[model samples]
Target: MAHCALEVADVFRSLGPGWHQSVNLSLGQLKVVSAIEQCRSAALGGHVLRCEGCAAIEVAYNSCRNRHCPKCQAAAARRWLEARQADLLPVEYYHVVFTLPAAISEIAYYNKAVIYGLLFDMAAETLRTIAADPKHLGAQIGATLVLHTWGSALTHHPHVHGIVPGGGLSPDRSRWVACRPGFFLPVRVLSRLFRRRFLEELEAVYHRGQLQFFGEHTELIDPGVFAKWLAPMRACEWVVYAKRPFAGPEAVLAYLSRYTHRVAISNQRLISLDERGVTFRWKDYRVDGRTRNKTMTLAANEFVRRFLLHVLPAGFHRIRHYGVLANPSRRENLSKIRALLHVALEAVDPDGDVSSCAAQPSFVCRHCGSPMIIIDMLQRSRPIRAPPPEQCHA
Candidate 1:
């Protein structure tokens, strides 16, 4: 049998050094280096267990399971969506995207900690504000916003994808105003508002000197940089498209499961890792090749370089809430919305819920309120002993 090491440690043993080199090579790419290194070994230990059929013994160390760690996000995404089941409403939900102007994104990457954070807040607020406008829906809506930094080509494009219910409660919070059956919010109007709100927030952050620019981006620190950067986007058509709303709740959960804990890439996508450089699959988005896996072979150095480009600043949030979903109002607003939408009773059975949906994780230690989570797990195989009970005399 072609047996490979079962634990993440083995993968890191072969790959960690290259990642470290990839980081030191570029100041710009250093963001994800530590994240990858931390994910390489099993710092969190686990007891050994024996396999039933093969009775093979191997170490199955724990995983860092960081959302950014490709090794960990899949299970996380599923869990997040699972919990969402109880929160979902029985209405069509729309997928709305809010994109930052290219003029700003260049600087945004350097100041990702601030600018991207602002983008999420602004985007979510815009959605909430607009939906609450007596002109739009009048009902305060709920949204799940997720941040993504890369475009299909691996370029640093900051954007937020919002999954929102079709309609919201009337201003009085008594009547349920169903959204246009097919359309949620008008895409064009939402896009423009999103652009303006984002730019305004960007300016606020800039004026406060909260934004940082390093190396070639140092020029952007000047007000002139802000003005020059803001001009093009002021007129640019910000893309806030409404995809076909989900056919139902099942579809909604399925859609979000792929994105909630997404990392730059996953391990299964890697085809080969030998001296032939690193061959992996990437989507050719220009041609809608997202579903079809196209193999990309890059020099080991280049591969590491691309992989490290996505690391976010430590403690930055890639997922966020707005409007009724914001922390202060989440519980109360959810209760009201549930009553209004007549979905207070989750249709799915409790037992069935666990197997089907994944919840957004808090990473809490349970013992403490801090953002605590398992960083890694290390598992070792146990030796299988013969059944001696039958001949205890030995």
Candidate 2:
């Protein structure tokens, strides 16, 4: 793919220092700003490469490898997909989404770790509960859920995207029980259960004094007010819907490759940064067709603020697997399921040799198709100097 002329790093490099002076940002958010600014720049040193075929030399800079960095996710996604490739079954797969209501999302902005963890748990539980019912699929299903905290316009809209197989193993583990050819579980049922479980947990967390309220939400610190505030969400419909099943395993892998490691926005979507503001393209899902694609510009400060809204709590796992695919027993479970389905176990490379592939260089010559060998190491540069303590505090 062609490199984007504009990138999030460019926006951060231009406005981040000034924004930092004006805003009181968390340590995590501040690190994100600094990392993006220096990503793939000389600040993080990288090795020099020389092409075997063309004898061309190139200097490559190291990526920050921050999960939130758009430039860093491609390799991360590639590595993740390779690991998951063996987990794919021949069965059809479905895409489901469970979204927190706007009111809850507002609370989530302050309690991201607690609320986002609840979202993942409840979504996974809802799927398992509904799927195991004798009346529904009546089987144990596995699902991979990915958390996306941003809307197209960089708004705080928290949702979990679920990739689930259309079927599961029988209670006794004797047979593979598949859902109806086209349908997975009922969305209405899943949504109601998810809403109930999430609210119950939220209330519990509130009682434990784990939730914090600020600004207009300060009144919610009172139990009565918090209950009243949650009243509307109890009756409102939480968005949970499942799309049609993927065409096949290949299509499912393709979908995972795109959604699994995505950041809030890609560099490709950035249009330009100029006197007007930072302009970028975004999709309005509420609309249909070409009209949904539109550009919006925000003052650099506001843009940075919106972008940081999704930094997430430190050490949070945004991607999770549940049910049969649960990490503890995934390999054994996959082995059993493949046997039950009469499918062959995932094959190793023919001749059982991988050293050849491993020996290949990661980069190639731009002009000639030949492996580029690392000719020399580049030590990391000293970190950019920070302002003096008095000046920083000022």
Tens-place lDDT per residue, model 1, 1-394, is 1222232223444564444442343332332344344453454444343443344344444555555667667667766666677767778988988887776788876688888888888777778787888777777777889998886545677888888888876777787788878878777778778878878887888899898777777777789866896788788787778898898998888888888777666665666767776666677655653465478876666665565567777677788777666767666777787776666464555433554333433343323333333434455233222222332221
lDDT of 2: 0.88
- lDDT of each candidate versus the true structure: 0.67, 0.88
Name the regions of candidate 2 deviating beyond 4 angstroms: 16-18, 288-291, 349-360, 383-394
lDDT of 2 by residue, 1-394 (tens): 2578999988877774566766767767777877888888888899899999999999998988889999999989977777787788989999999999999899899899999999999999999999999999999999999999999989999999999999998999999999999999998999999999999999999999999998999999999999999999899999999999999999998999999999999998899999888999998877644448899999877888899999988899999999999998787888899998889955545332322345556997888979899999898885533333443432
- Estimate the overall C-alpha local distance difference test score of candidate 1: 0.67
Q: Please report the TM-score between candidate 2 and the true structure.
A: 0.94
Task: State the displacement of the C-alpha of residue 383, model 2, in Å, after optimal TM-score superposition.
Answer: 4.7
Range of the 10 consecutive residues with the lowest summed lDDT in candidate 2:
348-357
